[model samples]
Target: MTRHLPARTCRDCGRNRPNHGRGLCRGCWLRQWRATNGRYDVATGTGMGGPGIPKTAADIAARLEDYAFLRALNVRRLDIAARLGVSYRTLNRYDARLRQQQDTA
Candidate 1:
């Protein structure tokens, strides 16, 4: 005997088809994945920007300032990253860069 699964409607297109998770059908899911350049998180359904914080000097300075303030409060690295809207790896890079500058000065 074969099991018959009920068709699921995609949240984006509303077409009935097999679900690919995140309440989206395969086609819609693939569309979203490509749209985000594969940054789509299937589990959280959010795309944390691939490159992370903008590369502008002012933006980097501002984020680093925020990072320092948050660090002074003893915030966890993960929390700091989320608050800064960056990934943990990016935060680590920022931290290292700041340390390097401080060392040189």
Candidate 2:
């Protein structure tokens, strides 16, 4: 006897996909995973990470540079936040803080 499988669509993007049991396609799942800093919890549909703060000046500078790069790419902030494993609000806050610091210098 042979079992049959049905094609499914990703819940996020509505793209045809395999049954991954999470209702999300590979690419969508990966985006979620990356947004969560590689800590996606399927059961809860959530992500976990440490405090959202740059530990050093170098780290802050690097992140600012990364933000600039993302801006140049014209990527949406939501996408950028997901790609960087942060919340949209957090991203906005960080950007505001960084911009303020830059202006003061």
Candidate 3:
């Protein structure tokens, strides 16, 4: 006979959804992951200043240079994202920003 286990609630949101991991629901878990990961501006499609991320204009310029260099080397976008410690979507945003900057310059 199989034993029934008690239902678990999310520790962070106190929701009745199924636990994902660390006693958090899926939404809570994803929020936590994003918070701990790199900073990103969803609406603006830009990287936000935070720990271990580019903040100043010079820093952003340096990152763009690195990204351009990687592209020149024909590195796969996914590989570049991994090397830069950012998500693929964020890398796409960076690419767009780079293009915009190039167009204006």
Q: Report, for every candidate in turn, its global Cα lDDT versus the true structure.
A: 0.73, 0.66, 0.72
Off by over 4 Å in 1: 1-54
Name the candidate that leads on lDDT. 1
lDDT of 1 by residue, 1-105 (tens): 965656898889989887777999878888787776633122121244334333698888998999999999999877777676666667768889899989999
Sort by lDDT, best first: what order?
Answer: 1, 3, 2
Model 2: colliding residue pairs? none
lDDT of 1: 0.73
Off by over 4 Å in 3: 1-54
Q: Which structure is stronger by lDDT: 2 or 3?
A: 3
How close to the true structure is residue 14 of candidate 1, measured as C-alpha lDDT? 88
Full candidate order by TM-score, most accurate first: 1, 3, 2
RMSD of each: 7.3, 11.5, 7.2
In model 2, where do residues sit more than 4 Å from their true spots?
1-54
TM-score of each candidate structure, all chains considered together = 0.51, 0.42, 0.46
